[model samples]
Target chain A: MPYQAVPCRVLSLTGGKRDNDLILPINSSLSVTLHQDQLKTTTTAAASRDFTEDRLWLNGEEADMGHPRLQACLREVQRLAHKRRGGSAEDAGPLSLSYKIHVATENNFPTAAGLASSAAGYACLVSALARLYGRDSLALQVAPETHWPELRVLVMVVSGEKKPVGSTAGMQTSVDTSPLLKHRAEVVVPERLELMMRHIRERDFEGFGQLTMRDSNQFHATCLDTFPPIFYLNDTSRHIIALAHRFNAHHGRTKVAYTFDAGPNAVIFTLADTVAEFVEVVKRSFPPATNGDPFLRGLPVGSASLPEELLAAVVMEPVPGAIRYILHTQPGPGPQLLDDPSQHLLGADGLPRCSA
Target chain B: MPYQAVPCRVLSLTGGKRDNDLILPINSSLSVTLHQDQLKTTTTAAASRDFTEDRLWLNGEEADMGHPRLQACLREVQRLAHKRRGGSAEDAGPLSLSYKIHVATENNFPTAAGLASSAAGYACLVSALARLYGRDSLALQVAPETHWPELRVLVMVVSGEKKPVGSTAGMQTSVDTSPLLKHRAEVVVPERLELMMRHIRERDFEGFGQLTMRDSNQFHATCLDTFPPIFYLNDTSRHIIALAHRFNAHHGRTKVAYTFDAGPNAVIFTLADTVAEFVEVVKRSFPPATNGDPFLRGLPVGSASLPEELLAAVVMEPVPGAIRYILHTQPGPGPQLLDDPSQHLLGADGLPRCSA
Candidate 1:
């Protein structure tokens, strides 16, 4: 059996739509492939196996292989592979429909921490499976990661703890109870997506940044509008949002943008030109917990001295250690295969590696 | 000239609508007069006064005499007084339109603390001036205070500091930026107000409490949807909201309801029967900063033991000093004239009393 692994999947700037009705009418998002932070998935398929069942491991823990979504993905892949064979044994050699598959996955960062771990995980899984089965899986690519080279993403990990309410359940409840969710999904999102695409195409940082923040806010607003209401953003998240707004308002332009997923973490978007200054501002507003190690990862941001007026403008009661740390990254390619055998998450024995 | 003082005014369960277009279509609210939390104002009209202009003092400090709203109220009162004289000099006695007015007002509670100070103060001013000028000011009242004797209000002073953004400007921004605000004001408010009124009329605490909380959350949701967004509820405010929801969900009934204005403070409503238990839950969730000098004021609430499961349901990190204090009050009379001269806020010189 041949094994394959894909690294560095994408995380979207916009939230995913789960409502089937809303998804059919209009479902769009602006996404950027992350370079530094990644989720790696390894897949191995055997036409003749000792074990007759498919198996999966996540972060060294064996998870439910019969998970409905996983089953659906596996069924779809096998169906495509069977069709490609066309009843002839010639095309089915090692990639036959009767093969059992073993999969192992792990993330370099925190899982279920609102860092889009599921998105990256699922994308990597499907991509790796497609490669193993010699099947082509079509996925939408609005613009390549290289389209905007100067764009940067800062993942502010406010809390890496698992969110109390999972996105699936939270969004389902929102669809059932929130009156404004329908309006937002049907009316606001489509128009905003068009504008976002335009801003990305034109590289209009200010327009892109403002729209990003507004859409994120409207999403949370709908959550708040839900019955028994949901509060995803905590004090630290709110403070980060306020700081972003103040920093932009002081400069009289949109210098920074912030988007929050289902949890308290914040993902900030800014251009390469303004990243240094904004980092300085963030550092001042949310002082790091310790001075021993670097509080930032990925692309290094040089220190920039902000003007007195600018510093004064964004000044608030600093909430020390509000942000645990930041992962500084930029747009890069989606799901690249690792050519090195040592990089595989699964060992040669068809099980997750001990260090995975 | 005779002086009169109205002791108590009212606070509504719903937020006030300032959008002229929305207000014209549907502007209804259910209010209850608070007995213990009162804003007292004393007014005297001198037919032959030495001073030519109207004078005013609020909380013993001289305020802007030419404030637009105050001026408009004064002009309307004088116009009514002049018309009532029948255009005959003999009909116009000491209570004449040419009289110069002197007004003094004070509140026992903290000013600008989201305690409905402005509402009470303005209502007191209008009621007092109308009596002095022999004019009648018709106000729409759905029900008097005695209508619901069991209904109680608990003012949770999350932070007594003045709100950063006043409700006036905040509503204007919402009208301009938030798409949901228009829908809420026009469609949601009227229907919700009807339901609230029916609940009040039928003494349905469950319905009334649920609608009150929903309306308040939607109001804040609109604020969140605004561009650059408005955050009226801080960490402590959000905690209180969550606690209320958890408590209600635990019992599978709406035992307590919370409503927040344009500030962090929470105004909670519960029936007399549930007030003691809910108060116990609140005390456990938010323990007092100091056990001395009773953390609760207004109507005394007898202690009740909450069940262990109920306590477990509302268990959260106690934010010490998050709430400064609580005011337990009940609905009472709107406004009454105090015949006692000693109760007047003004001295014999027609100025604010030194101790006022």
Candidate 2:
């Protein structure tokens, strides 16, 4: 069986309790899911006939198939598949429930480097699994890509270095130790999620941008409040934040908003109108290192001249190559199956076609 | 009449509501006050019959005499003095309430550089006023300097650059915007202050160090929660924090603690037994740039040998000259009068003795 792999950009992660057994959103959870053309993970999942055991390969290397979350996803997918086929496997044509599964996933971006690479990987893995087993995806989309055409995303790679504290362990420690995390989960997030959803639905960029920046700050605040504390945003990340705030302050409004995950990379959201100028601002603030790889990638941006005053306004010491690169992208369609045989990540030998 | 000058270090700022008028401790407030032989603000006050109007000189420049807080301190002192003399101005000598005052103050460290120089300045001003007016000082002492002789303070000067945001304005904005700050002020501080005082009384190094670190982190957390998000702890400050935590974890208990005010400099608290080793660790972590100022100052630190394992455990890229220098000192009595006439900052001409 062949399947499409879905890679997603998690705009805002708003939830407390994580359910290891289910793929669907809980009642209390609300996340804005969209797709970006760049920074994706491709997973090839198949129901194997000859193999006697379930196997998994991540980025061309063999990984534990018995990982709890992986097991949970596999179990849920199979159960959903069974339920879909009139509560039994007999209704399915050739795919059998007893067949062992083989999965291989490859990420275009750095894995576990806090660029939400895991989100894309997990999403792709589960989507591929669901597709192979004749089950529909249970992921609840807050809004379609068409809902906000002007919205754009910039993935600022401050550091692709592996996160000192990965998200799972960080969140667990935060849940156990942070009082601010408890307050944010129970009291702050619910109302904030509602406002975010409304802002997205109404295409209210100002409200949306402000809330996004504040929520990001508050989330990191809780991380700092954790016992022994967790530091995800390094100096470069903070400089980016200062630049964002300064850029907005210069405009006298929220023209751009920055968010950070479990690592130092910054995900900035802005409108199509503001993107060019803000990109210029970013370039001026964090000049690319000489003789390095290309500084900008993905969707092309128009040339915009930075005003002298605007350049002066964003006061920061330029740290060359602080940002590895800038990935410019926008709201895009979800997973699509590749009909051509050459597009398959796994080859005829049932192994990764290319090493990561 | 001539009066003594004083300077002190604010060990922990535990209360939220600030009084613009009084020098005494508010009912809900509790702070650990200690004096350092270095890093002080010196002030000289005199009741001058020759002067036509009250005047003030700060750091060798003639400053406004009508500043609200200064006027408030003067009025309070005069009222206390009048009351002490049977509520009659006639009972006093030639050094009467009606006489115009001349005052001069100087800070050895950088002013408003988040070293709590303002605290020292204010304490010195009020003490000088009280001494000249024959009124007893009313500042409540939580515990005297002799109580914790081994409790050492290391003022790690990460940057002497004036802070991006000053404490007064920053706190005002935080109070107006940050929900976490409000919660901390109203709900968190009261309980934490009690524990801090208890830790001091019990001489519980573990409890005291842990609480100190957490409170410092929480205060900065609230700062981050403020609108536009105030960022006082820069990269160097965060690196110092990481070093402190790693050092403690290596020992399997709390041996050292770090705190930050509204700037990047770190005020680390540790016991005498741990100071030498920790200073060695700091020197290793943030090695001094060649030809720069001396790395350590103030109280003498004995030689210490760092174990290979301990050095390997605290892994951080040595940020050369990230910390300008470390000022090492300990608890001492506050607000001592300089009886020798030569110590006065103001000469017989009622002007600053030296230009800043």
Candidate 3:
């Protein structure tokens, strides 16, 4: 099966909309690995330039550019690439290397369960484009030479249809001003968070949900008291918080921490070690309707990469379609150059091909 | 001139301490007027079958009953009163009324500033007695009953303490509660809250300090979120809240509101409001403080019951001795007659007072 030629594969990783403005870039590297099955394989070939105008074969048939946001994304990415290479004869020469791209996207989850689709989509598009254009290094570098501008471009492309709903800019500013930033300590999952994470990876939905809800509440509270108040949590958020608190207090601890993007959807983070206990507690505590099914069917636990032989764990998971697919990821280095050409998605002519 | 026992002169009235467990009753009446020099002068005294021993004298000392909370308050008030009423009560009767109460308190303003003293002190005692005596009403209605166990009893005998904290139970509980309670309402000072009651008048301090601070924050918020929050206006309180929000966007409208009890002490409540403008904006726009004066000072205003128009506007001046105070109070009912007089402080002989 050969990969099709598409500009970019937009992965709606988060199930819900995120406040684009809050997603400011930090001095850290971000990485992702795509599975073969996640893509669309096809034989049809179409004209290379003006892909937006052309009815390119998507999953199966010729797909039209129906959504304006999608079109804006395509144009924006192309513009950014041209800018990087230096525009026109007066500008620098063709950016290091260019390529024709192909994309395959899956809904993966249901519509509007308040999970974050924007985060997943943006993260996925950036990942896929980086792979296709061989700009992986630039994409992953923590404090890259082109930081703000590049981050803005990526944000614009990902936010496409959305009118930049205050991406991570404000949040970043707050972090900069935080006095506690100096004392910043990353809390690695002790046995508790770790066990929960493992359970999530194993598709233990109940257990995962319990831990995620609890952790999210604590995280948001911490944010609230940070110097000048930063409220990522609202009244509704608090109601949800109270519900989780009541649930945990009544039953044993279950999957509970909830992480909110600029928007209100909760990204639940659970501990890997206590998956079963967490799941059992959740099932026994919250109503089935609110918590969904007991077996926690269809939940996927994506594994995070770790150096030590720590317990296998899933950093994130799919809560049905409510949440975009979970990215099982861990700390990783910036993007690096690939020695093999076979992995390249583009030909010398800068057009994407099924087999390099 | 020898200070005569102004026949029937009531030195001060005090409703005892109120807390989660105890309610003390203040159901005795007496009438007296202060001379130009602020000395008590009695006009009428009811000759009831109840013995002279049943009468409470200002300087009369009382024995501790081993109740720590009660002991603490009685000791404090008595020490302050000194030997005004003369010797201690000999064999006072069994306390008739028993009150059970619950209290929740917080200051809306800076604690050390002195604005919280009166509000805190009054609320502490009144609430404590309400709990001790099982007086059911809210903070505004402990006195002024019509029939037997009459309002006079409460107003007269209770008014013997040298400097008793003012009570809001009478006013707050009198107002009706309705569904409209949920809707945000404005607190219009139809009239200033500082009107002087013949029995309870105001005093002026040369400058604003503690009272201003407490009223600006604690008292105001208390009133805003009262049993059903009431709103009192203090220009300074509003400005302060507005200023806080100006520096931080996360600050809400609910952050600032002011309320004043019978004394000069005031409190302010703060929260984010849906209005386009915010407390922060107001705070920033305000002029900087000059020298020692605060950027703003909260003035007390509310309706008084007197028929005469001039007296209606009588503003309570900040008394030097009156400290800033704040306490959180909710809706409650008025004082009731205790069915069991076994709790009465006077003995069966209806003469001398019991030990407690």
> Candidate 2: TM-score?
0.92
What DockQ does every candidate get?
Answer: 0.65, 0.66, 0.03
DockQ leader: 2
* TM-score of model 1 (CA atoms): 0.89
Question: Model 2 misses residue A197 by how many Å?
Answer: 1.5
Best by lDDT: 2
B1-356: candidate 3 lDDT, tens digit per residue: 00111111121122122232333422122222111111111111111333222122222233233445444554443333333323345412223211111112222233222232333333344433433333332423322322112011000000011211123342232123211111111121111122212213321211111122222232222222222223232223323332333323333222333323332232332221211132123322332334453322222222223324322222122122121121222112222233455433334443224232
B263-333 per-residue lDDT for model 2 (tens digits): 78888889999899999999999887677577888889998999999999985778777888898887767
**Residue B186 lDDT, candidate 3, scale 0-100:** 16
**How many Å off is the CA of B222 in candidate 1?**
0.4
Q: Give the per-residue lDDT of model 3 (tens digit) for A1-356.
A: 12222112111111111233333232221212222222222222222343434233332323454545455555555566666665653525332323344454323432122223434444444444444443332332222222222110000001001221232343443354432221211221233345553643465645545444433332332232233324343323333343344434544554344445444433333444433443333333222344343234323333333322121121111122232122321112222233455544344443444432
What RMSD does each model have against the real structure?
3.9, 3.1, 19.7
lDDT of 2 at A33: 45
The residue-by-residue lDDT of candidate 1 on B229-317, one tens digit each, is 88888878888998998988998999889888777888888888888898877777778888475688888889898778878878677
Q: How well is candidate 1 docked (DockQ)?
A: 0.65
User: In model 3, how large is the Cα lDDT of residue A319?
Assistant: 22
Better of 1 and 2 by DockQ: 2
After aligning candidate 2 to the native by TM-score, how far in Å is the CA of A198 from where it should be? 1.7
lDDT of 3 at B319: 20
- Residue A201 displacement (Å), model 3: 18
